[model samples]
Target: MIDIPSMQRAGANAVKAIIDDVISEKLDVEKKFSSSKTAFRIADLGCSVGPNTFIAMQNIIDAVQQKYQSQGFASHMPEFQVFFNDHTSNDFNTLFASLPPERPYFATGVPGSFHGRLFPDFSLDFVHSSFALQWLSKVPEELLSKNSAAWNKGRVHYASAPDEVAQAYTVQFAKDITTFLEGRAKELVVGGLMVLNMPGIPNGNPHSSSVTGLSFDILGHCLVDMAKEGLISEVQVDSFNVPIYVASPKEMT
Candidate 1:
């Protein structure tokens, strides 16, 4: 049960630029809609429990409304239907309960991974995901195999692991990203817009220099310390690893 607000602040800050870019971009909403009666469908991928998701959706809606007003369609504002997506095991109940009574859009919960198809073909006009793609569908299988070249033992992520271990995570991330994009491509309309914001390391910078990587290392050390004190078994610490992979900008491209 991590503090959702505090955990999401960094990601929220990182994506502000991208969100602004989307808002400023020429969306041609009126032309995209053509008919005045079409409902604008927006999907927030990986929208975990919270107020952060609400804020993000609100920003997007407000920006779109501004665009509509500028285009002389203020009188015929289309209805908005927003889909909040996340893994099936996510605390959707808490998310629903926390919804503001004054919410302007019709919100629906879509439970599933974003790595695969979650919507009908050409049904979505906009898609947003923040700090969510960093999570792989699952940890690389080779990392868990003792005999594998990428075996990541006594460590959690590829931060300080061998090159092969890092490569394995990179390969998995690429695969997952490909799947995510391909799925979204099928779901979004021809002129649809998608905005994604995820943590990325600078080019040529060692993972250790990144805050996230350093934090993982510190957590690993803490776990080892706990094991040494017999509060937790060393074997347990050795077997556990986080499923997140922080990619570089080049890797993303």
Candidate 2:
């Protein structure tokens, strides 16, 4: 559920900040945008089914509404449209049901990695993603087929890991980043700003045995227990690490 007070403040402020940044300098995405009707096209990439998402969407709308109104652009009342997207597996039904009947915003499930063409060429004015995109996809089979010291080289239960497993995870994360940027470059119209806010390891660290601290170690232990129970295999447990990205922000940049 949407936290009433928190969202009313943070969500609202986040929307205002983005709009202000773009509209003020005519910077980022709003720079090249010239529209007669003022129909602004905005999108929230990786919008999941939740109150936070809804609240954020509303906040963005409110900010944009206030923006054009103040500019004497009120007469045209820039036609407004919002697109809420997530991976295809997202619970769109839940999102839509939570939405009001009037539907001030339009919502859709794009069902693909948000890093790519969620919209047509030069279509978006602003794009926002909160708390999504970190996971790499399922580990590849070839890497884990052998439960050996080579593939499953680091079989420690909790505290340690081998270098190769780390490499496999890192490689996938880089691929995800590249894919994401490639898609965004094509979809976002020049001047469109795509704000991606997600958790990352401090600085530009590749998530490593150095990072993840103890939490991931606990996760590894759980996996080992599961493997012993036959809930999974040594091969499965061999592939550790969150599928999500934990790389440094500079790397993402």
Candidate 3:
């Protein structure tokens, strides 16, 4: 059984703090942020199947609502929409089926990556991607553009991978970040915020299979073992991944 709840909470806590601190402190621009009734517009990118995503979404909604109500508009609450996103492999039925109908919030699933834009132009205010950006896309076909080795299909996990392999994965991730930031920038109306949190080892990452570098390795391995046991057909893990984000307070503002 996967502890999706705990995993969701850990990630959600990051967003919660970011939202709260932003609302309380100086997020982008307070006057600009407060000008709208929405208070905060957010998206949970890479939110997989589980109750945790919903809880986190609800937490953000509640916080934003409270922020709005305290502003003296308790009767006329603002509208908000948070799109839950993930790869095509994610269990959308499970995620949507589990969505609590009692909540008065708009939610939907965007089939793609948080690293990719899911909404139309200028359609968001805040974006939260937790614990998911670390996993690079399977691999780019042109990984060998500069004569690098091809990424094998069975090489599961990115921790402790060869330098070149890791570089390939890292480069792909950078492309994703470029896509994500560029897309979000177009959608955000000047004062939007994006909070991206994932597992990363500061500067001690070395090329080795036993790198125990990221906590996500545990989740990925469970999937690997399932594949090994024939529970899941095959495994195609990236040999390298660099868990780094390219967002700053200046860029978000």
Candidate 4:
């Protein structure tokens, strides 16, 4: 498994802010769910192996319950059906094994890519993704083609890449995000809520100078060192690139 304590810590730190924002938008939830008498259907997109996913889902459930109760609809509280989605190759057995016995909602695993259609139209009431959208569906094909202007030579990502390479990645990210939104739009019911949390570059900051960019630079240096030590070939390093892009808020909008 990918053991990154810092990553988990960062995710935990952001959870409160995310939950608060979602709760503050209770008016929207009330509007959507007030008339519904059926079980609430929630989909946690890109929800990887758990603890964090559990916390997020519980917070959403609590927020929804509180919203309905505040509206004097305590008797109308709906059952929850939570779907944890991830790639087909993900270790779903491990994810399901760690579920808490006291979970308030019924849970199931949905293995598929979020960049494409994974559910039927208008079937979901809430959707969430955390620290996941930065991952592109696939690397930009142009970056790997020697004849393409966006050839990403001597690098694994767009951190210090040339303008053309950076542009290629940016274009690819836009396309992926568009596909993701389109898929979600078709799946979610009217007034449904979607919360997406991803790494982003600040406005007025250079993309290559951001904290995430710098981290990628350090990783690239390590890969270069490995190549020098004959642990891997320089050509392999040049050919391989991370299918991740830290977009700006403006880009997302």
Q: How close is every model to the real structure, measured as TM-score?
A: 0.92, 0.75, 0.69, 0.92
Ranked candidates, highest TM-score first: 1, 4, 2, 3
Residue 138 alpha-carbon offset, candidate 1, angstroms = 0.4
lDDT of 2 by residue, 161-224 (tens): 5656566656677877788777777777666666665555667443444344345666677778
Q: Candidate 3: give the clashing pairs.
A: 122-187, 160-208
Relative to the true structure, how large is the alpha-carbon lDDT of every model? 0.84, 0.61, 0.62, 0.83
TM-score of 4: 0.92
lDDT over C-alpha atoms for residue 14 of model 3: 63
lDDT tens per residue, model 3, 101-121 = 886677778898656667877
lDDT of 3: 0.62
Question: 193-212, model 1: which lDDT tens digit per residue?
Answer: 89887777899998778777
On a 0 to 1 TM-score scale, where does candidate 3 land against the true structure?
0.69
Segments in model 3 whose C-alpha atoms lie over 4 Å from true places: 1-5, 26-41, 140-158, 204-253
Poorest 10 consecutive residues of model 3 by lDDT? 244-253
